[model samples]
Each structure stands twice: as structure tokens, then as C-alpha cells.
Target: MPMSITLPGPAPWGFRITGGRDFGKPITVSKVTEQGKAAMGDLRPGDIIVTINGESAAEMLNVEAQNKIKQSPGQLRLQVERWVLMGHLCNVNLVIPNRPLAPQNCRCLHPKPIPLHPNPSLAPRPRRCSHPCSSHPAPPPIPGALMLPSPPGPVR
Candidate 1:
């Protein structure tokens, strides 16, 4: 079951959304702009949107969802569900009022990516150099095997 809510917007939705996970997958809330209508309305990350304006969000593609949001003016309805602790799901009902976001007050939802470092525990350990003649050990000679001194001529 999905929770439904009506959001009144004067400008944009102030949130980025993505869909098309598989077939019939609900649109997911990727990011919520700070101090925007979505943030003020209590929308968060990982919210699976099931419907928009009474239309099935799961049935719509990613482009469809974007188009729907773009075409919608004034008010927009949404049905979303969020996963809570202990594998339980909580339905959220939000009525976001779209107001003109001030440029100075608006914050970016997409943050800069940070470089990831490899975990020390998962990193490969360096091999020890034990051979006396060289850093690496030489291959041992196989018993009961013939060793060729020179290369053999090509057979006709």
C-alpha cells in the first residue's frame, strides 16, 4: 500500500528523481534540495515514489516521470514508501507547497564526490623475497623429464 499526498508547487519540485530500475519499479528520490519544497515537506533519500498525481509511478518510465513533473504546475500528488528499521516499511504522506526558492538560500542536492581509499584489511600483502640467488625463487627441475639444450627444427 502507498501513502498519497498533494503538493502545491509554484516553481520546480526542488528534487531529483530516478526510475526504471527494472519493469514496474517505482521512481526513487535521488536527492532533496536543502531548504527546498521537498526538504521542507520532509522528503528524504531512498523514498520509492509509487504515484504522481494519481498516475502510477511504477508504470511510468524515467523520462515519463520527468515529463510528468515538468508538465505539472500548481499542485502535484505523490505516493511514496520508505523502508524503516527491522525490515519494516513506513508510508510517508507529504503535501509540499512549491514556493520560489531564493538563489542565495538554495543549496545543491548533489554534493562533490570524494575519492575512496582501499581498506587496509582487504588489500593484498606483498610477497616476501626468500631466494638467495634472486628476489624470486627459480622453478624446480621435474624428475624423470628430458631437458632440451637447444631449440628443435620445425617439422615439415
Candidate 2:
């Protein structure tokens, strides 16, 4: 889901927007300075700009998008497609934590809820484990879980 983040600012916006014709990819947030306006807002590194002040980001050139943001009155309302939803925007890796890759109830480590679901904010990830599997049954998998597609092959 696209989020509308209101960045209260004057200029610079404390962030950078890259991509579009200048970069040969969709308009994406290339950087967010720490403790900056954009950092304080919901903007992240891989967020793809869907709209800027209700203007279609996909339709505008990079320079045009920058101009729109630059000339904004006070606040900038950005409609951004999150990396989690768009899947690896700006060549960023979808981090797979060091959790057990084993199946549920397989005498492996306790399964942790994969927070990379529809809304990651809902599920906070557990801390990393230093030891190996505890020789216990893995927690039951979540129904309708996002499973990685099997390797390509002709099903015999």
C-alpha cells in the first residue's frame, strides 16, 4: 500500500530522490540523511515514488519531479511504494535474517514469524540466535505465507 508521508520542510528536504530517466529506473529514494526531514518522515532508502503532491511520479522526468518538490509551499506529500511491496527497489536486498530455514515441526529451531508480510510494522523480528537449532519442533508455519517459488524446471 502506498503511504502518504507529509514532510514538513523548506528545501533540500534532507533527502535525495534518484531514478527516472536520469537513472533508468523508477523514481526511487536514493538516500535519507539521518536526523533529517525525510529521515524524520516515513521515507526510506528503497521507497519508489508513486506520486508527488498528487502528480504521477511515473509520468514525470527526474528533473520535473525535483522541481515539483522544490517549489512546494510548505509540506511535501509523497505517495511512495515501499520496497517490501515492490520487491527490491533500487537493487536493495530483501534481508533474510539468520533464522532457521527449516520447515515447521522438523526438530529444528523454533520458527520465528517472518515480518516481511503485507505490513512489517505489525510483526517485529526477534533477536538473532547465536547457537544452532535447539533440537525442538519448529513453530507452525503461517497460513498463506509468502513462499519462495521453487526453482524453475519442467514438472515431470
User: Considering every candidate listed, which one attains the maximal lDDT?
Assistant: 2
- Across 1-156, the per-residue lDDT of candidate 1 in tens digits comes to 344656678658788887654544568888889988777776666667877778877777788888887788788778776432110012311111111111122122211111111232332222322333232211233233222211122110
Estimated TM-score for each candidate = 0.50, 0.55
Model 1 spans > 4 angstroms off:
21-25, 87-156
Whole-model Cα lDDT per candidate?
A: 0.49, 0.58
> Against the hidden true structure, what lDDT does model 2 obtain?
0.58
> Model 2 off-target regions past 4 Å?
85-156
lDDT of 1: 0.49
- Lowest lDDT sum, 10 consecutive residues, model 1, at 93-102
Q: Give the per-residue lDDT of model 2 (tens digit) for 1-156.
A: 566789986777977888786666778888899988999985777777889988888967889888998998888999885522111212222232222232222232232333233444443444443335332222234453323312122111
Worst 10 contiguous positions by lDDT, candidate 2: 85-94
Query: How many pairs collide in each candidate, listed in order?
Result: 2, 0
